[model samples]
Structure formats: structure tokens, C-alpha cells
Target: MTHPEAHKSHRAGWLRAAVLGANDGIVSTASLIIGIATASATQEYILLAGIAGLVAGAMSMAAGEYVSVSSQADTENADLAIEKKALENDFESELDELTEIYQTRGLESGLAKQVAQQLMAHDALGAHAKDELGITDTTSAKPLQAAFYSAVTFTIGAALPLSLAWAIPGHLLVISVAVSSLFFLALLGGIAAKIGGASITAGALRVTVWGALAMSITAVVGNFFGVATQ
Candidate 1:
């Protein structure tokens, strides 16, 4: 890949983090706001609930991502340590074990043996780690990093609609949030696609469509309750 593309993929991790974080922010926060709004249209109450939701939601996302990713990182570290010890203790046996793994991947007997022989000569530790242990393309669990990214992304997403509600007329509150949320979702989809090297048009279409469906369902529920209560 070119320099710019490599830069983008490096940013890809952040992009993925943002997408997951923002998506949770939008859906959960929107649902919470709508549910709270249904309970009472009082602007103060809605605003209060939105603020509380933002803080709680962000904290929840951060804590959850950190714990999960950290656990994965721990497990991977443990596996790597064990693999290293096994290599140090029993070199020949480990070499044979690596050969069997390649055989399972459908290499002919002689070819597999040659591969094992050459790979062991080149880097015995790498060979056994890749074949026997299944930890080739490594991905570390970045719990703290993920948590920070998630919380920030979520806060940004959640704040958009809440700010719109505050700026617009109270009577127009719900519609504004609905419209702005769709706009953000579409923007998010396009950004996500571009980051992942996917078709932006398709990504935008799918996410916006789903956002519409979600908002519509909630609207139906809101109206049903609105009428029933009256």
C-alpha cells in the first residue's frame, strides 16, 4: 500500500473504534432520550436525562471495552510466553509438531518437511509460534486505548442531537433530533466505508436506511402512547 493508504489503515483502528463507539452512542442515547421524552415532555427533565445518559453511557462503553480488550491481551501474552518456553525446552519435538501442522494444511509430505526444515532454520521460534500456536498475525487487546476512543466518540455522537434539541424550538424538538441523527448516521457510514476501503454509497445507504427504520419504529411507539394517554 501507498503511504497515504497505510496512514489510513493505521487510522483504520481509530475509525473502527469511532464507528463502534458512535453507533452505540447514537442508538442507545436516542432510545434513552425518546423513552424519557415519552415519560415527560418537560424540557428540563429531557435535558437532564440526556446529560445523565451521556455520562453514564460513555463510562459504560469505556469500562466495558477496556475490561474486554485487556482480558484478550492478557490471554495472548500468556499463550506467547508458554510457546516461548516450549521452544526453549524441547526444540526437536516442537519442530516435528510444526511439521504436522503444515501437513494438515495440505502440503505434501516431502514439501511439508522441507517447509518445516527451512522455516526452522530461518526462525524456529516464529515457525512454531505460527503453526503450532496459531498466533501469527498478532492483535493485542488495547483495552485502555479502546476505552478512551469509545468514550470520546460516544460523547461526540450523543451531544449532537442533544444540542439540536436545546437550540431548536421545544415544539420541534423530536423532529430535529430525528433529522439530525439520520444525517449523522449517513455521514458516519460514509466515513466508515472510506476508512475500510469499501463503497461509500452502499455504506451510506444501508446505515441511513436502518436509522430511518429505527426512528420510525420509535415514532410509532411514541404516537401510540401519546394517543392512548390522552
Candidate 2:
């Protein structure tokens, strides 16, 4: 018999970090450019600000992901270690525990015991890790992978706004960057949601709305400060 299609939950870990990094990179860099441009800052200053934001933001995302995912990994390892100790100290209790866990998941008592026995015989730690700890191979955290994807995606997303800021004329810099950044955010959000098997429209609209708000606020602040300075 054929199995039905599986959900995309496996992509949860990296997809979240990657999407967040990209969204922040685009929104923050674009907002910075628009804000500086509204302040009547020179092209050099605007570009400088975007570049600085891109670098700083990318580094921050990377470091944050690494630390957080590393902590998760550590916790998983600790739990697994405890389980291993318990199994070694009392195999029967551990076996019974596994059987009970399966039963709770809707298996018949006899079937649960049989299945647990077979699973434990095959790989006791693996069975316990999968059923008891809910730590499967797909959902396992990888700090380095998270850090690398976050930093790389952040850099790529930030580059879009920075490039527009550099190429667009001064007279049109603010609007151009704002529009382009929103477009990128929407696209990224839709793509991320689609991959994650969610509503594309909701994701796209969510990011775009937030990006517009951020840029608008920064622009207003910049304009106020510019007029005040003058």
C-alpha cells in the first residue's frame, strides 16, 4: 500500500530563520535608506547607511540564530542523555514507559507493547527519542545550518534595497526604495508561505503591511529631523 503525502513541517526550522532574516534585511535596509534620503542626506550617506545596516543586521541574525539553536540542541542532547541513563539503569521500566506512550497515542495495549518491544529491540534510544522526546531526525536543530542560512539570506535581501538606493536618482530615491522593498517583502513572504504550505496571500500581505508601516514611520521621523536641523 502507498502512503499519503506528507506535510512540510520538516522545513519549519530553517524556513523560519531564513524568512525572518530576509524580511528584516529588506525592510530595515530600505527603511534606513528612505529615512536618510528624507533627511536630505547625500547619496553617499544613504548608501553608507544601507551598507552598514546590511552588515550589522546580517551579523546579528547569524549570531542570534546560532546561540538560540545551539541552546535548543543542547537541551535535546541533555534530555537524550537522561533517557539513555534511565534506560541503562532500568530497561523494563523504560520499555513499559514506551508502551504506555504508544497506547496513549491510540494503539491497543497489547499492540502498543508489541510495537514498543520491536522498536526498542531495533533501536531503544531512537524509539524513545522519537516517541517520548518528540525529537525526530527532521526536526533536530542544527546551529551552524541555521546561522549560515540566516546570514546569507539576510545579506541577499538587504542587497536588493541597497542596490536600488545606489542606482535610483536622488529625486526618486525614497519612493523607489519604498516600493521596491515592499515588493520584495511580499514576494519573499508569499514564497515562504507557499513552501511552508500556508496561505500565500496572508503571508504576503502581512509582511508588506509591516514594511510599509516601518518605512512610513522612519520617513516621517527623518523629515521632521531634517526640517528641525534646517
Candidate 3:
């Protein structure tokens, strides 16, 4: 009999970082452009602001992802090191620990011990790491990968709004950016959710609604400042 295919939990690491970075890039850059346009800023100034936001946002995403994921990787490595030492110092207890874990997962006591013995004989540290500590190969953290994906995706997403700002006239810039940003946000949300096996409509609405609110607030603030300065 054929076994069922495994789920895509392995993609969680980079997919989540990339999607978040892209969404932030689109929303934040578009909002910045819309805000500046609403404030009666010149087209040149608006485009410059968008470019600045894109560059800053991408760099921030990269740095943030790298630091956070690196911390996680460090912790995982420390835990594995501790577990390895434990296995060397107390092999019997480690084997019993694995056996208990299997038993908790519904294996019979005798069978659990037998299975644990076999696994320990084959790869003791691997068995402990996977079952006891929940650190598998797929879930192992990679800081560089996360950082690269986040920065690249952020740049790509930010470029969309910047391109529109460059092409659209000043008079219509705010509305055009607001609408287009929402569309892109919704699209990205749907695509990311689909890849992550979540509800598409929910994801789309979630990002679009928040994106609209963000743009709306920024526009209002810009208009208020514009009028005050005038």
C-alpha cells in the first residue's frame, strides 16, 4: 500500500519570511508614496521617498531576519550539543528517554523499547534530536537563506509601487497607489496562503483590510500636515 504524501511544513521557514517581507515592502512603500503625494509633495520628491523606503525596508528586513533566525539556529545548535553530551555520558538514560517518548506517542511499552533500541543503535543522537528535541533536518534554521529571501522579496515587492509612482501623474498618484497597493497586497496574501495551505479568502482580506487602513491613516496625516504647513 502507498503512503500519503507529506505536508509542506519544510517550506515554513523561508516562505514565511519572504511573504512577510514582500507584504511589508508593498504596503509600506505604497503608503509612503501616497502620503507624500497627498501632502502636495512634488513627483520627484514622491519618487525619491518611495526609493528610499524600498532600500531601507529591504535592508531592515534582511538584518531582522538574519539576526532572529541566527539566534534560533544558535539555540538549536546549543540544544543539540547538550543532547549529544547527554547521550555520551548517559547512554542508558537517553535510550530510556527515547523509549518513553515513543510510548507517549502510543507505542506499546515493549515495542517502544525495542524501537528505541534499534533507532539508537542506528543513530542515537539523530533519534534523540528528532524525537526528543523536535529538531529535524527540514526545520533546521538557516539564517543566510532567510535573510536573502527576505531582502530579495522585499525589493521585488517594493519596486511595484515605486514603478507606479514613477509612471502615474502627481494629481492621481495617491489614489492610484492606494488602489494598486491593496490589489497587490491581496494577491500576495492569497498566493502566500495558498502555498502555506491556509484559507485564501481569509488571507487576502486580512492583508487588504490592514493595507487599506494603513494607507488611509497615512493619507489623513499627510493632508493634515499639508494644510497645517500651508
Q: Which of the numbered candidates is closest to the native, going by highest TM-score?
A: 3
Give the Å error, residue 98, model 1. 3.1
Q: Give the lDDT ranking, best first.
A: 2, 3, 1
RMSD of 1: 3.6
**Per-candidate RMSD, Å:** 3.6, 1.2, 1.0
Ranking by TM-score: 3, 2, 1
The residue pairs found clashing in candidate 3 are none
Candidate 2 least-lDDT 10 residues? 168-177
- Per-prediction TM-score: 0.79, 0.96, 0.97
Error of 3 at 8 (Å): 1.9
Q: Which pairs in model 2 have colliding backbones?
A: none
What TM-score, to 2 decimals, does candidate 1 have? 0.79
Residue-wise C-alpha lDDT for candidate 1, range 42-145, written one tens digit per residue: 77877888889899999998998888888877887788788788878997887778778888999988888889989989988777766776555433456778
Pick by lDDT: 1 or 2, better one: 2
lDDT of 2 at 125: 98
- Candidate 2 lDDT, tens digit per residue, 1-230? 99989699989988998998899899889999888899999999989989999999999999999999999999999999999999999999999999999999999999999999999999999999999999998999999999999999999999999999999967888888999999999999999999999999999999999999999999999999988998
